[model samples]
Target chain A: MNTTLTERILGGDVRSAGRLMRWVDDDLPEARHELAALYPHTGRAYLVGVTGNPGSGKSTLVNALVAHLRASGKTVGVVAVDPTSPFSGGAILGDRVRMQQHSLDRGVFIRSVATRGNLGGISRSTPAMVQVLDAMGFDVVIIETVGVGQDEVDIVRLADTNIVVTVPGLGDDVQAEKAGLMEIADIFVINKSDQTGADRLLRELRTMLHLRPRDAATEWTPPVLKTIAVRDEGIDTLLTNIEAHTSWLSAHGARHQRDRTRAQQFVRLIVTEALSHRLNHALASSDWQSTLDALLARTQNPHDAADALLNAILEPR
Target chain B: MSQEPKPRTYRVLIGKPGLDGHDRGAKVIARALRDAGFEVIYSGLHQTPEMLVRIALQEDVDCIGLSILSGAHNTLMPEIVRLLEAEGAGDIFVFGGGIIPENDIGPLKEAGVRAIFTPGTPTTEVIEYLREACANRYQ
Candidate 1:
């Protein structure tokens, strides 16, 4: 059954993926090993990361993109990352209910991952999940974010193409400028074009685009396409722009870009892993939890005490 | 006389159709189902017609509870129902519940949806309906 699970996943079996996701969440060590073996089968799918502020119509835009891709005869996989509430530590994947049209399509797959305090805009398991999607041989993978914070921007580094969706009337343009959003957009989508100020925002976006030397230019520079995703208006142009970007990246040594991104992903993971190990073995090995009580009681200096714990770990065995 | 203290359990597949990202209802329903003792295999969001059918086949699930809030139900669900029939999963029961309106209900039911749960329908009602459906299917 276990081997079958892996095989079915490779075969793009939906039940298999659902079971595997749970296995991942449960931290089954074997599941990790099995997935590692499946990694090479990935790198086939074109990963497109879509990010923007919360309520920027990212889900709606993604829905349109998926529809376009399906119409063009491509299988798609989507990863929607939502923030886990700090107080409850539970995933609020409410976003999944928004794009429910593909429920019956065999060629599309979507999974929601919780950003469990992961700083760079995803849960630790996200990149791996994307790899799983890629291995499943999806023609395209769309990653929709919880929002476009600094962490959200970081998701761009993992994708071959990054689309930053912007809406009008939310001061999103100014926020985008302040957040350095323009730096990462491969294609900028002005959604809700029916609303006024979208054209103004598009002009501002173009003006911002003009000021910079192209980050990675090819046959096509990043284009700003206007869309009313709710009405499914203007999605084809946006999708065409996305295709343009991907082919451009492929011709421009997407391999090197992927390596660069993958290296950073691993580095982040390793550093977090090492630090966590240090906390678990080096610091928590001591009577640290109670020591904080003493510090709270003014009997010890937390700074010195923290240093002592680190020093103990540094001493080794 | 009825038997005392019956063991209540239900099985459901919580599925998503197109690209709608409003899964708040699905997640809440999944939790409610789990608490209600139904083993749920949630297919998450953005599932294509084929993927959902594939899942429904393998899980051998009794019920497929689709959560469609995207307003694309007309374009999506009929295709799924057709696919399910083609795949010989025609015996499996299918229903939908979400932000659908009164006007859309008759068409959905006409398309062979067992029942449609709209907003304000309690989770208990869903559980009870499933329990009855599963029993009827088994019988």
Candidate 2:
């Protein structure tokens, strides 16, 4: 009668899924084994990523989106990320507060994660937690990143549909005219459209889209939509657009390519993290102290010392 | 780069249960805990015991810090503890802070609340207690 955590997760135990997510966050070595077991059961849940600047209503929009998805009889899982303090490594993951309506819903599972010094607006363990939720049979998994600026495009690699949320009067229209978060969006949401300057922001976004070079016959131009997430306005339209994007991806076979790209990135990240762990261990060894001493004494050049250290770890005696 | 594995970052849930709309105490505590380097999940006002327990389980938090100012602490705090225990998550530490009377603290603790920080208790005490309690819980 004894079942492993992986087995329980596969059997749809939500508690086991939460425990596995905690393990992944803490970087427990056993988490890797569980994830390996759960990998094959993934790829079934559609991943949706919502990102925007702070105070842009990203969480509120996600709350509205989840409510809409649930009304249509779909199970949902959310990974909400908030930034950790660089000084203290702490975070206030208040995203769930906006989503308390689904707190007791069996079909909805929401987990909050801290960036924990990882850049790119999400925690290092976010993808693994997504995998856990996917394996637990949630029909859709939504990732809400920390209030991101420009360079946090990592969500594009993981999410099947990336919705970049923007609010009017934040000067985002001007800031987004550049090529970072603006370029990565599969759909653009001008949230809080009830506010002033909404029309101007929409016009600017449309103009920017118009200027971008694309084959109208072949390319999927990301739609610019408007929403007042707090009042649940325009959410149904947003969901329809999301479903449309999904259909587009499938119709064009782009979903398969995206999956391949995600797999490649995931494998590379695992290898990089493993090697970095080993390198950290190696750097604390006596060999590194002597290498540092030689460098300090000017007896060895910086490049040669780097090569020696790499060789020492790569080809250990 | 440290030789030892990274210390597990403790996730604490600050919840307000029952009809009490006042969450200043909870927000203060949540911010204090965040500044002290703990990931704090804030459960907004008027959460039921069922909702709090469900959030705690889903969040996999190390502790649930309940802030109930309504005279309903007697009814609410123990209910949260009972709900958490019923879900087989009694290991998740339960603590409370609010306008609870002195007489109710013992009964609440007896009902499985680990600690109760009445009004006027410094935030540092709670922070220090959590750090020690969470660190010792695993060992």
Candidate 3:
């Protein structure tokens, strides 16, 4: 049964891939088992992350980018991450609405993930979802984040090509320079280019990019492209720049370094998960309960109690 | 004894099938479910039965709440159930809401829809039913 499902998933069974993603979302042990079996087939798909302020039309740009990629006959997988509702723990996942044109096309697979209270715009299971799609043989995987935030920069850790999308009339150059996005953007796009302040935003971004010190080994400078995504304008040039960036990463042997960082993050996430689970288990013990009680009664300080608990759990186990 | 496994959050796909275009009910339920702590995937308007099932399968949702007001519930709801069964995903609990009339509710239930909620049903009542249904649903 396992082999059949794995084989089906590897052969591009969307249902199987989705089932596996469900496992990942629930943090089921089966997901780890399945990923272990499918790990060898991953590491092929190009991951592109698109993130920007909420009204910047990142989803529309992604929809346009998907259309352009499909025109080139490449299979695409999209993971649109939306904020989880703190009140109800639900998400609207409205990004799919803008990309509805690709719904009927089997060449594209789109899934929306709630951030599940993860600070970053991406979901905790995003990297696993990307790996699942990659093993499923998608030529490209696009991760659209939950708009822009300081924490949203986490996408740069996972995506080989990260596009920081901005629009005119939102803010001046200082506003752009203030966010964590400037450091991570491999390509900058000024979407909604026909708007009133687009030229000023473009000129300011170029000036900012020029003023920033260049990395000695960084050959590809982040290019700011203009696009009216709703009308499907400038999508081709955007794709071209993305391709150029991908080629640069490969030729400069930086793809391996990026992959290494991604793997490192994956390992750290797993370790964190494991440690957290163990900590929760240990906290439930009678000894820890008494420790908490003592602290509550002012017999023990929180720092000492915490240190003792850490020592007890971390001691040569 | 080892501790019992944590209750995994329920993931639901609140889909609007057919050409209804009226998604207010679907959006309301999606919000209520989310607020009640269920993870929801709001599949927007104009989805076909096939597309709904495809999404259900892909999202691996525990249940699907179909909202149809285009007077095509009798056809679309059953078709979704049929497709889920055909794909060996019959274990996915299927229920629906929208302008479904009282007379058609019986037939929809017989067609494998687990439950039906018509207009004016309290959001709390729906949440309670889902809590129970998903609690006992096959994993």
Overall lDDT per candidate, in order of appearance: 0.74, 0.90, 0.87
**Interface DockQ per candidate:** 0.11, 0.65, 0.53
Q: Summarize candidate 1's per-residue lDDT along A177-282 as a digit string, tens digits.
A: 7786777778888888889898899898888777767555443467888999989999888877877776777688864777677757757875677567777775
Runs in model 3 deviating more than 4 A are: A2-4, A215-217, A289-308, B1-7
- A1-317 per-residue lDDT for model 2 (tens digits): 39998999898777778788988999988788999999999999999999988899999999999999999999999999999988888888899889989998999999999999899988999999999999999999999999976787889999999999988887755688763877888999999898999999999998888888988766789999999999999999999999999999999999999999999989998888877877888899998899899889999889998887777667744
RMSD of each: 8.4, 2.8, 3.0
Tell me the deviation in Å of residue A126 in model 1.
1.0
Residue A51, candidate 3: C-alpha displacement in angstroms: 1.2
Local accuracy of candidate 3 as per-residue lDDT tens digits, A213-306: 8874866799999999999999999999999999999999999999999999999999898878778988999999899889989999999988
Order of the predicted models by DockQ, top scorer first: 2, 3, 1
Top TM-score: which candidate number? Answer: 2
Clash pairs for candidate 2: none
Worst 10 residues of 2 chain B by lDDT: B1-10
Worst 10 residues of 3 chain A by lDDT: A88-97
Better of 1 and 2 by TM-score: 2
What's the CA error at residue B105 for candidate 2, in Å? 1.1
Off by over 4 Å in 1: A2-4, A148-151, A213-221, A287-317, B1-139
Stronger candidate by lDDT (1 vs 3): 3
Each candidate's interface RMSD (Å, one decimal) is: 7.9, 1.8, 2.3
